[model samples]
Target chain A: DVKVTQSSRYLVKRTGEKVFLECVQDMDHENMFWYRQDPGLGLRLIYFSYDVKMKEKGDIPEGYSVSREKKERFSLILESASTNQTSMYLCASSPSGTGIGQPQHFGDGTRLSIL
Target chain B: LAKTTQPISMDSYEGQEVNITCSHNNIATNDYITWYQQFPSQGPRFIIQGYKTKVTNEVASLFIPADRKSSTLSLPRVSLSDTAVYYCPLAGGGSTLGRLYFGRGTQLTVWP
Candidate 1:
């Protein structure tokens, strides 16, 4: 089974603080993604990495960035945390850039609270 | 990603079969219909995927019509643990890297 592990399960940060959320996958998948889930709106993509050092913006990328220094790790960075940034963050990894009918396995998720 | 429409919520009882339908009127020929189940406070878990006709797995069965405009996910004999938010991620095709877009899912509650 594919294992995607997020650095923190629950996190709290103050406004204007820079926060970092990390994700690591043991499956050596080439594609990693970061998404924020909100009530009623569902999960929206924030950023995704296709390969090491390559990143792309998703639908909701404002105030967020990503890092993929290695194949197994992908990190989401919140430039300045705000109360509105509080959400459930999810990390997912797929086997390849174009995984035919393959699913993106996700981590348990990190509940981030910005005060 | 194709737009998908599903029931906002559904309710079922233990030992009863639950069928959730999702409509994707604009689904492309190459698009694959996939379902994911998410428990409270957890990320979505992959359920099943299918192109057309019927596909059955140990977890669930996927039924697609010839028009491919809609799909049905059938859970046999659901229990309380089967309660969750079910999402249909009609995946984008080809070199786009199969990125999936999720809409407001169908919340399914199972009672004993």
Candidate 2:
């Protein structure tokens, strides 16, 4: 079984603070994705990395960035957290090839609250 | 990625089969249909994927017709644990790479 672990399950941060959410996967998959889930918006992609040090902006990457220093770890950084940033953050990984058709494994998710 | 439309919610009883259908009228030829189940406060879990015809897994079954415009996810004899949101996303090949559009999924509630 594949395991994707998020660094925190529940997080709280003040406005204007820089927040970091970390995720690590055990299966060594080449594709990692970050998404934020809001009430009516569903799961909107924030960022994704197909290789180490390579990242692409997703549909909603306005205030967020990602880092993939190693194959097993992907981190999402909130440059300046705001109350609007409070939402559930999810991380997922999938094997290489076939692009969007490949099955992805996901972590439990990190519930972030920006006050 | 093609936009998918599914029911907002469904109600079912235990020991009964639940079929959730998603419509993707603009699905490309190379696009594959994928289903995901997400529990409250958890990330979406991949259930099944199929291009056409039928594909069955331990968790669920995916049925896609020849036109490839829609797909149905069948969960057999569901329990309370099977209650979750089911998302049907069309995943295409090539440079799109790991990008999926998850619309508001069908929320299924299984009762005892």
Candidate 3:
């Protein structure tokens, strides 16, 4: 079965601290994405990558950056964590195609808390 | 990308068929409609997808009208487990990359 795993399921950090969230997919999909989900606002895209070393910003990319040094691994970085950044972060990957019809496999998200 | 609109919430009884409709008036020719189910605290899972006509799989059925202006996702004899937030995503045009946009999906609650 295809699997997407996150490095951490939960994390707590102090304000102004740097944070990283790691995601790995076993399906070898070419596209990976990071999103933050908040109540009423829904899931907002942060960034996505089509290949190694390639990335693009989504609707809301502020205060976040991404790295895809390897095909199966994608990392999301919080430059300096803030209390407003507290939310559930999800990582997803899909095959390289225009097929929005294709299902994206997702990792069990990381719930981050910044004080 | 085409924008989709769906109900904010709906209530249904167990063992009843539930149909949730999504409207995408500006859907392009190459765009396909995809439905996803998301439970609380979990990521959304794909339920069905279709370009035109009726498409059915093990989990659910997708029905698209001739005009392609709207689509409906039909769940057969829904159970309490069927309660979830259903999102309808519109695919980008031909040869474009897979960039998914999530809208405020419809929340379905199945009761006994």
Candidate 4:
């Protein structure tokens, strides 16, 4: 079984504060992704990394960035947390391939609250 | 990625088979259909994937027709734990890399 672990399950931060959310996967998959889930919006991709030190912007990447210093760990950084940033954050990892038909393993999401 | 349309919600009883259908009218030839189940407050879990015909796994089964415009996910004899949101996303093909576009999934509620 694959295990994707998030650093926190519930997080709270004040406005204008920089927040960091960490995720680690045990499957050694080559692709990692970060997403934010909001009511009525579903899951919106924030950032993704295909390999270490390589990252791509997803549909919603404003005010957010990602870091992949190692193969097993991916981190999402909120440059300046705001009330609007409060939402559930999810992390996923998938194996390397043509990206066709590959199953992604996800971690129990972190519920972030920015006040 | 092709946009997928599924039901907003469904109601079923325990010990009954549940089938959720998703439509992707603009699905490309190389695009594959993938199903995911997400519980409340948890990330989506991959259930099954298929290009055409039928593909069955321990969790669920995927059925796609020849036109590839739609797919059905069948959960056999579902239990209370099977209640969750089911998402059908068109994955892969062309320059999509691995980005998956998830819409408002079908919320399934299994009752006793």
Candidate 5:
């Protein structure tokens, strides 16, 4: 089975703290993504990488950054955690190509809380 | 990316077939319709994907019209476990780098 592993299932941080969320996929997929899900706003994309060291901003990229040091690992960083940033963070990966019809496999998610 | 609109919620009972429809009026020519289902505490799972006509797999079916303006996801014989939030997203924006935007999604509730 294809697996996407997130470093933490739940994380809590104080305001002004820097945060890191790590994701690793075993499928060797070329595309990796990070999204944050809120209660009624739905899942909003934060960042995505098409190749190692290549990253693009999604619709909502403010206060977030990403790193793709290796093919299988992608990391999301929070420069400064804020209370409004508390949400469920999801990591996903898919095969290389235009996502036209390609479905992404997602990790269980990391619920991050900022106080 | 083409924007998708769906119902806020739907209700169905066990053994009943539930259909969730999504509207993407601005879908481009190269775009494809995809659906994802997310449970209460887990990440979203892929349900089905289609470009046009009908496509069925072991788990669900996707019905797309000729105009590509809308698509329906049909889930047969629903049970309590079938309850989840279903999202319809389109792969459209100009770049082919696997970028997809998601909407609020439809919340389906299957009653026992």
Candidate 6:
């Protein structure tokens, strides 16, 4: 089975602080993604990495950045956390860059709270 | 990415079949339809995927028409614990590397 693990399940940070959410997959998948889920707004993509050192902005990438220095690890960075940034952050991974039917395997998710 | 449309919410009782439909008018030929189920405070779990026709797994079944414009997810004899938010992701053609576009999912509530 493909297993994706996040660094934290619940996190709390103060305003203007830096936050880092980590995700690791054991399936050697080439794709990884970060998203924030809010009530009524749904899950919005923040960033996605196709390969090492390659990143792309999604619909809502503001105030968020991603790092994929290695194939198995993807990190989401919040440079200056704010109350608005508090959300349920999700991480997912899939095996190749060019398959339409591959279902993404997700981590447990991290609920971040900014005060 | 193709945008998808689904119901805002649905209600069903245990031991009854549940069907949820998602509409994707601009779906491409190479695109695939996938569904995920998410519980409160947890990440979404993959339910089923299909390009066309019908595909069935232990958990659910996916039915796609010839036009591939819309798809239906069928849950058999659902249990109370089967309640969750179901998201229909319109995956792009070619590869899975494309970022999935998630709309407001359909929240399913199962009653006893």
Per-residue lDDT of B9 in model 3:
94
Worst 10 residues of 2 chain B by lDDT: B90-99
Tens digits of per-residue lDDT for model 6, A42-85: 89999999889989888899999989999999999999998999
lDDT of 1 by residue, A1-115 (tens): 8899999999999999999999999988888999999999888999998899999989999999888999999999999998999999999998774424579999999999999
Local lDDT at A29 for model 6: 88
**What is the C-alpha lDDT profile of model 2 across A80-103, one tens digit per residue?**
999999999999999887633478
Candidate 4 ranges beyond 4 A from true positions: A99-101
Give per-residue CA lDDT, model 1, range B26-94, as digits (tens): 998888889999999788999999888999999999999999999999999999999999999887678
Flag the better candidate by DockQ, 2 or 5.
Answer: 5
Model 3 chain B: weakest 10-residue lDDT segment is: B91-100
Residue B90 displacement in candidate 5 (angstroms)? 0.9
- DockQ for every model, please: 0.67, 0.67, 0.68, 0.66, 0.70, 0.67
What candidate 2 gets wrong by more than 4 Å, as runs, is A99-101
Which lDDT value does model 4 have at B64?
Answer: 94
Which candidate would rank higher by TM-score, 4 or 5? 5
Number of the candidate with higher TM-score, 1 or 6: 1
TM-score of the second chain, each candidate in turn, equals 0.97, 0.97, 0.96, 0.97, 0.96, 0.96
**Looking at every candidate separately, what fraction of the true A–B Cα contacts under 8 Å does it contain?**
0.58, 0.68, 0.66, 0.61, 0.73, 0.69
The worst-scoring run of ten residues by lDDT in candidate 5 chain A lies at: A94-103
Q: Is candidate 1 or candidate 4 better by lDDT?
A: 1
* Model 5 lDDT at residue A87: 97
Clashes by residue pair, model 1: none
Task: Compose the digit string of candidate 3's lDDT tens values, residues B21-97.
Answer: 99999988988888989998788887888889999999899999999999999999999999999999887756556
Clashing pairs in 3: none
Sliding window of 10 residues with minimal summed lDDT for model 1 chain A: A93-102
Residues B1-112, candidate 5, lDDT per residue (tens digit)? 8889999999999999999999999998988899999998788998888889999998899999999999999999999999999999887535757777789999999988
Q: A22-92, model 4: which lDDT tens digit per residue?
A: 99999989989999999877888899999999999998999999999999999999999989999999999
Question: How far out, in Å, is residue A86 in model 5?
Answer: 0.6
